[model samples]
Target: MHPGGIKTELGRHTDPVAEAQMIRTINQRNAAAGLPPFRYKTVPQGAATSVWAAVVADGDVVGRRYCEDCHVAQIAGDPEVRGGVQPYALDPDRADALWELSEAMVGERFDPLN
Candidate 1:
Protein backbone atom coordinates (compact mmCIF):
# COMPACT_ATOMS: atom_id res chain seq x y z
CA MET A 1 0.00 0.00 0.00
CA HIS A 2 1.15 3.53 -0.78
CA PRO A 3 1.39 6.20 1.86
CA GLY A 4 -1.59 7.84 0.18
CA GLY A 5 -3.71 4.83 1.12
CA ILE A 6 -3.81 3.52 -2.45
CA LYS A 7 -3.72 -0.28 -2.70
CA THR A 8 -1.53 -1.78 -5.37
CA GLU A 9 -2.20 -5.24 -6.80
CA LEU A 10 0.66 -7.49 -7.80
CA GLY A 11 0.89 -10.78 -9.67
CA ARG A 12 1.12 -13.98 -7.62
CA HIS A 13 4.29 -15.28 -9.28
CA THR A 14 7.72 -13.68 -9.16
CA ASP A 15 8.88 -12.43 -12.56
CA PRO A 16 12.62 -11.87 -12.50
CA VAL A 17 12.78 -10.45 -16.05
CA ALA A 18 10.11 -7.85 -15.30
CA GLU A 19 11.69 -7.07 -11.93
CA ALA A 20 15.07 -6.51 -13.60
CA GLN A 21 13.51 -4.08 -16.08
CA MET A 22 11.86 -2.21 -13.22
CA ILE A 23 15.20 -2.04 -11.40
CA ARG A 24 16.84 -0.64 -14.51
CA THR A 25 14.20 2.06 -14.72
CA ILE A 26 14.74 2.87 -11.04
CA ASN A 27 18.50 3.04 -11.60
CA GLN A 28 18.05 5.44 -14.51
CA ARG A 29 16.01 7.81 -12.34
CA ASN A 30 18.45 7.41 -9.46
CA ALA A 31 21.39 8.19 -11.72
CA ALA A 32 19.66 11.32 -13.04
CA ALA A 33 19.31 12.43 -9.38
CA GLY A 34 23.03 11.62 -8.66
CA LEU A 35 22.11 8.73 -6.34
CA PRO A 36 23.60 5.27 -6.20
CA PRO A 37 21.77 2.43 -7.91
CA PHE A 38 20.04 0.08 -5.52
CA ARG A 39 21.40 -3.43 -5.15
CA TYR A 40 18.88 -6.24 -5.12
CA LYS A 41 19.29 -9.39 -3.08
CA THR A 42 17.27 -12.52 -2.40
CA VAL A 43 17.46 -14.00 1.09
CA PRO A 44 16.14 -17.22 2.57
CA GLN A 45 13.12 -17.17 4.86
CA GLY A 46 15.22 -18.26 7.87
CA ALA A 47 17.64 -15.35 7.34
CA ALA A 48 14.78 -12.90 7.00
CA THR A 49 13.13 -14.23 10.13
CA SER A 50 16.35 -13.87 12.12
CA VAL A 51 16.86 -10.31 10.86
CA TRP A 52 13.31 -9.28 11.80
CA ALA A 53 13.67 -10.92 15.24
CA ALA A 54 16.90 -8.98 15.83
CA VAL A 55 15.26 -5.73 14.79
CA VAL A 56 12.38 -6.28 17.19
CA ALA A 57 14.79 -7.17 19.99
CA ASP A 58 16.59 -3.90 19.31
CA GLY A 59 13.34 -1.98 19.98
CA ASP A 60 13.22 -0.37 16.56
CA VAL A 61 9.82 0.38 15.08
CA VAL A 62 9.40 1.08 11.39
CA GLY A 63 7.67 4.45 11.15
CA ARG A 64 6.27 3.82 7.69
CA ARG A 65 4.46 0.76 9.08
CA TYR A 66 1.98 3.19 10.63
CA CYS A 67 1.68 5.38 7.55
CA GLU A 68 -1.63 3.77 6.54
CA ASP A 69 -3.22 4.70 9.85
CA CYS A 70 -1.89 8.24 9.66
CA HIS A 71 -3.08 8.67 6.08
CA VAL A 72 -6.51 7.29 6.98
CA ALA A 73 -6.88 9.89 9.74
CA GLN A 74 -5.64 12.58 7.41
CA ILE A 75 -8.04 11.63 4.60
CA ALA A 76 -10.98 11.13 6.96
CA GLY A 77 -10.78 14.79 7.88
CA ASP A 78 -11.62 15.78 4.29
CA PRO A 79 -12.95 13.59 1.50
CA GLU A 80 -13.40 16.25 -1.19
CA VAL A 81 -9.93 17.73 -1.15
CA ARG A 82 -8.30 18.29 -4.52
CA GLY A 83 -5.18 16.26 -3.74
CA GLY A 84 -7.24 13.37 -2.26
CA VAL A 85 -6.09 14.38 1.21
CA GLN A 86 -5.82 17.69 3.02
CA PRO A 87 -2.37 19.11 3.56
CA TYR A 88 -1.08 18.51 7.07
CA ALA A 89 -1.00 22.15 8.05
CA LEU A 90 -0.56 21.90 11.78
CA ASP A 91 -0.92 24.98 13.94
CA PRO A 92 2.00 26.22 16.07
CA ASP A 93 0.72 24.55 19.24
CA ARG A 94 0.21 21.19 17.57
CA ALA A 95 3.57 21.40 15.87
CA ASP A 96 5.26 22.11 19.17
CA ALA A 97 3.48 19.20 20.79
CA LEU A 98 4.62 16.91 17.99
CA TRP A 99 8.17 18.10 18.38
CA GLU A 100 8.11 17.49 22.10
CA LEU A 101 6.66 14.04 21.69
CA SER A 102 9.23 13.13 19.05
CA GLU A 103 12.04 14.35 21.27
CA ALA A 104 10.78 12.28 24.16
CA MET A 105 10.39 9.23 21.98
CA VAL A 106 13.59 9.35 19.91
CA GLY A 107 15.71 12.17 21.26
CA GLU A 108 16.91 15.07 19.07
CA ARG A 109 18.12 12.95 16.20
CA PHE A 110 15.38 11.07 14.27
CA ASP A 111 17.29 7.82 13.76
CA PRO A 112 15.04 4.80 14.00
CA LEU A 113 17.79 2.42 12.96
CA ASN A 114 20.07 3.47 15.79
Candidate 2:
Protein backbone atom coordinates (compact mmCIF):
# COMPACT_ATOMS: atom_id res chain seq x y z
CA MET A 1 0.00 0.00 0.00
CA HIS A 2 1.19 3.52 -0.80
CA PRO A 3 1.60 6.13 1.89
CA GLY A 4 -1.58 7.51 3.43
CA GLY A 5 -3.56 4.48 2.33
CA ILE A 6 -3.71 5.62 -1.27
CA LYS A 7 -3.95 3.04 -4.01
CA THR A 8 -0.92 2.84 -6.26
CA GLU A 9 -3.01 2.79 -9.37
CA LEU A 10 -4.46 6.13 -8.41
CA GLY A 11 -1.04 7.70 -8.93
CA ARG A 12 -1.55 9.88 -5.91
CA HIS A 13 1.78 11.59 -5.20
CA THR A 14 3.67 8.37 -4.69
CA ASP A 15 7.39 8.47 -4.20
CA PRO A 16 8.90 6.06 -6.69
CA VAL A 17 11.78 5.06 -4.47
CA ALA A 18 9.51 4.34 -1.55
CA GLU A 19 7.13 2.41 -3.73
CA ALA A 20 9.99 0.27 -4.96
CA GLN A 21 11.01 -0.44 -1.40
CA MET A 22 7.47 -1.38 -0.50
CA ILE A 23 7.34 -3.74 -3.45
CA ARG A 24 10.51 -5.37 -2.26
CA THR A 25 8.97 -5.85 1.16
CA ILE A 26 5.87 -7.37 -0.39
CA ASN A 27 7.99 -9.75 -2.45
CA GLN A 28 9.93 -10.77 0.60
CA ARG A 29 6.73 -11.55 2.46
CA ASN A 30 5.39 -13.48 -0.50
CA ALA A 31 8.57 -15.53 -0.66
CA ALA A 32 8.28 -16.33 3.04
CA ALA A 33 4.71 -17.46 2.45
CA GLY A 34 5.62 -19.56 -0.59
CA LEU A 35 3.49 -17.39 -2.82
CA PRO A 36 4.52 -16.13 -6.23
CA PRO A 37 5.98 -12.66 -6.13
CA PHE A 38 3.95 -9.86 -7.60
CA ARG A 39 5.43 -7.91 -10.47
CA TYR A 40 5.78 -4.22 -9.76
CA LYS A 41 5.60 -1.40 -12.25
CA THR A 42 5.42 2.34 -11.89
CA VAL A 43 1.89 3.19 -12.85
CA PRO A 44 1.76 5.78 -15.61
CA GLN A 45 -0.37 8.86 -15.38
CA GLY A 46 -3.96 8.28 -16.59
CA ALA A 47 -3.55 4.52 -16.49
CA ALA A 48 -5.81 4.28 -13.49
CA THR A 49 -8.38 6.36 -15.28
CA SER A 50 -8.49 3.93 -18.16
CA VAL A 51 -8.69 0.94 -15.87
CA TRP A 52 -11.34 2.56 -13.71
CA ALA A 53 -13.41 3.35 -16.79
CA ALA A 54 -13.31 -0.26 -17.89
CA VAL A 55 -14.27 -1.44 -14.44
CA VAL A 56 -17.15 1.00 -14.23
CA ALA A 57 -18.40 -0.21 -17.58
CA ASP A 58 -18.40 -3.72 -16.20
CA GLY A 59 -21.17 -2.82 -13.75
CA ASP A 60 -21.18 -1.93 -10.09
CA VAL A 61 -21.48 -5.46 -8.76
CA VAL A 62 -18.56 -6.67 -10.77
CA GLY A 63 -16.54 -3.57 -9.94
CA ARG A 64 -17.29 -4.00 -6.24
CA ARG A 65 -16.18 -7.59 -6.34
CA TYR A 66 -12.98 -6.63 -8.10
CA CYS A 67 -12.22 -3.88 -5.57
CA GLU A 68 -12.90 -6.26 -2.71
CA ASP A 69 -10.62 -8.85 -4.17
CA CYS A 70 -7.75 -6.49 -4.94
CA HIS A 71 -7.88 -3.99 -2.08
CA VAL A 72 -9.66 -5.80 0.72
CA ALA A 73 -7.44 -6.32 3.74
CA GLN A 74 -4.77 -4.13 2.18
CA ILE A 75 -6.06 -0.73 3.19
CA ALA A 76 -5.60 0.56 6.72
CA GLY A 77 -8.54 0.28 9.05
CA ASP A 78 -9.76 -1.12 12.34
CA PRO A 79 -9.87 -4.81 13.13
CA GLU A 80 -13.34 -5.24 11.71
CA VAL A 81 -12.22 -3.66 8.44
CA ARG A 82 -8.71 -5.03 8.45
CA GLY A 83 -6.92 -5.71 5.15
CA GLY A 84 -9.36 -3.59 3.20
CA VAL A 85 -12.14 -6.12 3.46
CA GLN A 86 -14.17 -2.96 3.34
CA PRO A 87 -12.01 -0.58 1.31
CA TYR A 88 -12.77 3.11 1.46
CA ALA A 89 -12.12 3.16 -2.29
CA LEU A 90 -15.33 1.23 -2.74
CA ASP A 91 -17.36 4.07 -1.32
CA PRO A 92 -20.09 5.12 -3.79
CA ASP A 93 -19.05 8.74 -4.02
CA ARG A 94 -15.45 7.87 -4.61
CA ALA A 95 -16.43 5.34 -7.21
CA ASP A 96 -18.53 7.95 -8.97
CA ALA A 97 -15.67 10.45 -8.99
CA LEU A 98 -13.34 7.85 -10.41
CA TRP A 99 -15.77 6.98 -13.13
CA GLU A 100 -16.27 10.61 -14.01
CA LEU A 101 -12.58 11.35 -14.10
CA SER A 102 -11.97 8.25 -16.15
CA GLU A 103 -14.57 9.25 -18.69
CA ALA A 104 -13.25 12.76 -18.85
CA MET A 105 -9.72 11.62 -19.37
CA VAL A 106 -10.45 8.86 -21.83
CA GLY A 107 -13.27 10.50 -23.71
CA GLU A 108 -15.31 7.34 -23.58
CA ARG A 109 -18.67 6.54 -22.15
CA PHE A 110 -18.98 3.51 -19.94
CA ASP A 111 -21.36 0.97 -21.37
CA PRO A 112 -22.42 -1.40 -18.62
CA LEU A 113 -23.12 -4.23 -21.05
CA ASN A 114 -19.83 -3.87 -22.84
Candidate 3:
Protein backbone atom coordinates (compact mmCIF):
# COMPACT_ATOMS: atom_id res chain seq x y z
CA MET A 1 0.00 0.00 0.00
CA HIS A 2 1.11 3.56 -0.66
CA PRO A 3 0.77 4.53 2.99
CA GLY A 4 1.19 8.18 2.02
CA GLY A 5 3.04 10.37 4.53
CA ILE A 6 2.91 9.62 8.25
CA LYS A 7 3.14 12.13 11.11
CA THR A 8 5.53 10.09 13.20
CA GLU A 9 9.15 11.16 13.65
CA LEU A 10 9.86 8.34 11.30
CA GLY A 11 13.19 9.47 9.90
CA ARG A 12 14.69 11.06 13.02
CA HIS A 13 17.71 8.78 12.86
CA THR A 14 18.67 10.04 9.39
CA ASP A 15 21.88 12.03 9.07
CA PRO A 16 20.94 15.65 9.63
CA VAL A 17 23.52 16.94 7.17
CA ALA A 18 22.04 15.03 4.25
CA GLU A 19 18.39 15.34 5.19
CA ALA A 20 17.94 19.02 4.40
CA GLN A 21 19.78 18.75 1.11
CA MET A 22 17.67 15.79 0.03
CA ILE A 23 14.42 17.42 1.11
CA ARG A 24 15.30 20.60 -0.75
CA THR A 25 16.09 18.71 -3.93
CA ILE A 26 12.95 16.59 -3.77
CA ASN A 27 10.66 19.45 -2.85
CA GLN A 28 12.19 21.47 -5.65
CA ARG A 29 11.02 18.74 -8.00
CA ASN A 30 7.58 18.79 -6.42
CA ALA A 31 7.43 22.57 -6.78
CA ALA A 32 8.39 22.30 -10.45
CA ALA A 33 5.30 20.19 -10.89
CA GLY A 34 3.24 22.79 -9.01
CA LEU A 35 2.49 20.41 -6.16
CA PRO A 36 2.92 21.34 -2.54
CA PRO A 37 5.86 19.94 -0.61
CA PHE A 38 5.32 16.62 1.17
CA ARG A 39 2.88 16.41 4.07
CA TYR A 40 1.96 13.58 6.44
CA LYS A 41 -0.77 11.41 7.95
CA THR A 42 -1.04 10.93 11.68
CA VAL A 43 0.72 7.82 12.99
CA PRO A 44 -2.48 6.22 14.28
CA GLN A 45 -4.36 6.88 11.04
CA GLY A 46 -1.44 5.74 8.95
CA ALA A 47 -1.87 2.15 10.01
CA ALA A 48 -5.54 1.76 9.07
CA THR A 49 -5.21 0.96 5.39
CA SER A 50 -2.28 -1.34 5.97
CA VAL A 51 -4.18 -3.23 8.61
CA TRP A 52 -7.14 -3.50 6.23
CA ALA A 53 -4.98 -4.86 3.44
CA ALA A 54 -3.11 -7.33 5.60
CA VAL A 55 -5.70 -8.65 8.04
CA VAL A 56 -9.18 -7.78 6.85
CA ALA A 57 -9.18 -7.60 3.08
CA ASP A 58 -9.65 -10.86 1.21
CA GLY A 59 -7.24 -12.50 -1.24
CA ASP A 60 -8.91 -10.63 -4.13
CA VAL A 61 -7.33 -7.45 -2.78
CA VAL A 62 -3.82 -8.87 -3.05
CA GLY A 63 -1.24 -7.15 -5.27
CA ARG A 64 -3.25 -3.95 -5.46
CA ARG A 65 -2.25 -0.59 -4.04
CA TYR A 66 -4.52 0.67 -1.24
CA CYS A 67 -4.98 3.96 0.52
CA GLU A 68 -6.35 5.12 3.88
CA ASP A 69 -10.04 4.64 4.75
CA CYS A 70 -10.06 1.41 2.74
CA HIS A 71 -11.51 2.13 -0.67
CA VAL A 72 -10.05 1.28 -4.06
CA ALA A 73 -7.99 4.31 -5.04
CA GLN A 74 -8.20 6.54 -8.07
CA ILE A 75 -5.21 5.89 -10.32
CA ALA A 76 -2.71 8.76 -10.44
CA GLY A 77 -1.09 8.69 -13.87
CA ASP A 78 -0.39 12.39 -13.92
CA PRO A 79 1.77 13.80 -11.14
CA GLU A 80 -0.31 16.97 -11.25
CA VAL A 81 -3.19 15.04 -9.78
CA ARG A 82 -3.51 14.52 -6.02
CA GLY A 83 -3.54 11.14 -4.24
CA GLY A 84 -3.81 7.88 -6.22
CA VAL A 85 -1.94 4.72 -7.05
CA GLN A 86 0.49 4.40 -9.95
CA PRO A 87 -0.43 0.96 -11.14
CA TYR A 88 2.34 0.56 -13.72
CA ALA A 89 4.94 0.35 -10.96
CA LEU A 90 3.23 -2.45 -9.05
CA ASP A 91 3.72 -5.48 -11.27
CA PRO A 92 5.05 -8.87 -10.20
CA ASP A 93 8.48 -8.53 -11.80
CA ARG A 94 9.20 -5.36 -9.84
CA ALA A 95 7.93 -7.00 -6.70
CA ASP A 96 10.22 -9.99 -7.19
CA ALA A 97 13.19 -7.71 -7.74
CA LEU A 98 12.40 -5.90 -4.53
CA TRP A 99 12.09 -9.17 -2.67
CA GLU A 100 15.42 -10.44 -3.97
CA LEU A 101 17.21 -7.24 -3.05
CA SER A 102 15.69 -7.22 0.43
CA GLU A 103 16.70 -10.83 0.97
CA ALA A 104 20.22 -10.07 -0.18
CA MET A 105 20.43 -7.21 2.32
CA VAL A 106 19.04 -9.08 5.34
CA GLY A 107 18.74 -12.79 4.63
CA GLU A 108 20.94 -13.67 7.59
CA ARG A 109 18.88 -11.67 10.05
CA PHE A 110 15.40 -12.56 8.80
CA ASP A 111 13.54 -15.31 7.01
CA PRO A 112 13.35 -14.67 3.27
CA LEU A 113 10.53 -15.13 0.78
CA ASN A 114 10.47 -18.46 -1.00
Query: Using Cα atoms with residue i matched to residue i, what is each candidate's TM-score against the true structure?
Result: 0.30, 0.34, 0.53
Off by over 4 Å in 3: 13-39, 62-69, 79-82, 107-114
lDDT of 1 by residue, 1-114 (tens): 123212124333658698778668767766766666755323343244344544443334433222222222244243232222334533556656777798898767563442
Error of 3 at 30 (Å): 8.3
lDDT of 2 by residue, 17-106 (tens): 998887787777767666666553334422543454455445543343434222312444543322343456658787778888998899
Residue 70 Cα positional deviation in candidate 2, in Å, after optimal superposition: 11
Model 3 worst lDDT run, 10 consecutive residues = 61-70
- How badly does each model clash, as a count of residue pairs? 0, 6, 0
Alpha-carbon lDDT of model 1: 0.45
Ordered by lDDT, highest first, the candidates read 3, 2, 1
* Cα shift from native, residue 63, model 1 (Å): 6.7
Off by over 4 Å in 1: 1-12, 42-114
Better of 1 and 2 by lDDT: 2
lDDT of each: 0.45, 0.52, 0.68
How well does candidate 1 score on lDDT at residue 110? 61
Candidate 2, clashing residue pairs? 72-83, 72-84, 73-83, 73-84, 73-85, 74-83
